[model samples]
Target: MSRPRPGAGAALLFDMDGLLLDTERPVFEVFVEEARALGLEDAESFGLSMVGLSSSICQRLLRDYLPAEIGLERFRERWDAGVRARLAGGIPLKPGVAEVLERLTGAGWSMVVVTSTRTVTARSHLGEAGLLDHFLDVVGGDAVPANKPDPAPYLIGAERAGAHSRDCLAFEDSDAGVASALAAGCEVHQIPDIRPPDRPVPQRGQAVHRTLTDAVAAAGLLV
Candidate 1:
């Protein structure tokens, strides 16, 4: 695809979980399993609702659904154990992630990870997936004052890349992520994973595509 050159010094902002790493489904499955084990009703539905949210926010939300006697701490311990076991080998990369990253890297665009996962966990997962070297920095949920659906994470990501948000192109896979990127003044392309977007994604300077390769092609980043 032939297109206008990207702005000089433009950077790429990426959401790590569903967008770059195929970790959402397995992790969420663990959440549902743990919730079910604790006898929570509508476990799958509740777990899906937590997608794209920060761990802190999800824990808060879980408080309302979990029985008072069960305790959030207990549920969290089991859930965390399940997730670790499921990911003990390594996290898998999303479809087209390698190609998209390679293309963008070859184009000389700096990249930063903007994720709701905690900084240490995000770094570890990316390192295990062999994707850590592709990004210049990671702006994790714990690193920001607020997480997704808020602009702080993406704004921090842009700042870390030493570029203005407006000059950055963000790739996400969830509505909350898309909203965060857009609110941070970056152009966004969402590639939905476990769940399709329930809210209306803005059309101007934002788009939804089926895969990372398709999104990159639409952005004229694939030639």
Candidate 2:
């Protein structure tokens, strides 16, 4: 795999869930509990499939398993309320995240957070983490007409950062995000969470890293 350096004027983009925040496991636990309550036996698998996708997309993905009486809108509201209560404490940051962010900021890279989380939730989470100041802007899941696995979100992120997509380094933790960033023409690094991608990698111009620390190291950001 080729290790790309962040040269002058290069930008950085990040995915929120699972990648920067340690929210996936706990959030998925809530998902499982909700699904079981709704009498869906494949809750675990369903939860896994929803990783890295926006709530809107997850709703569609889960439509088939939803009980007809409950309906999509009501199911979403109840599930969101459950997850929100569970996450009321705070979202935890991934290991070495602050160090990497500090180093990258010191090196003068413009940064943006491009996430599949809705704008309201994304803002709340980042503000709670005190990480909002680290980014120049945020492109939320609702900001684009399409979500991950589509290039729109990442493309918009690059545009908002005022950098060409090819000059940006996108960090993500799932195959969906990887595909999005790659399609947008960024040099992407995937740091797997929960499990490795079912698809083979390098994934065109993207590379897989063991962790965010490894990604920062390879990017030579500490220099």
Give the top-scoring candidate (lDDT). Answer: 1
lDDT of 2 by residue, 97-178 (tens): 8788877777777899999998888888988987888899999999999999999999999999888888888999988999
Q: Candidate 2: deviation at residue 200, Å?
A: 7.1
Assess every candidate by TM-score.
0.92, 0.90
Q: Please state the error at residue 123 of candidate 1 in Å.
A: 0.7
lDDT of 1 by residue, 82-127 (tens): 8889888879899888877877787777899999999999999999
Worst 10 residues of 2 by lDDT: 1-10
Candidate 2, which segments miss by more than 4 Å at Cα?
1-7, 196-205
Per-candidate RMSD, Å:
2.4, 2.5
Indicate the residue-level lDDT of 95 in model 2. Answer: 85
Output the number of the TM-score-best candidate.
1
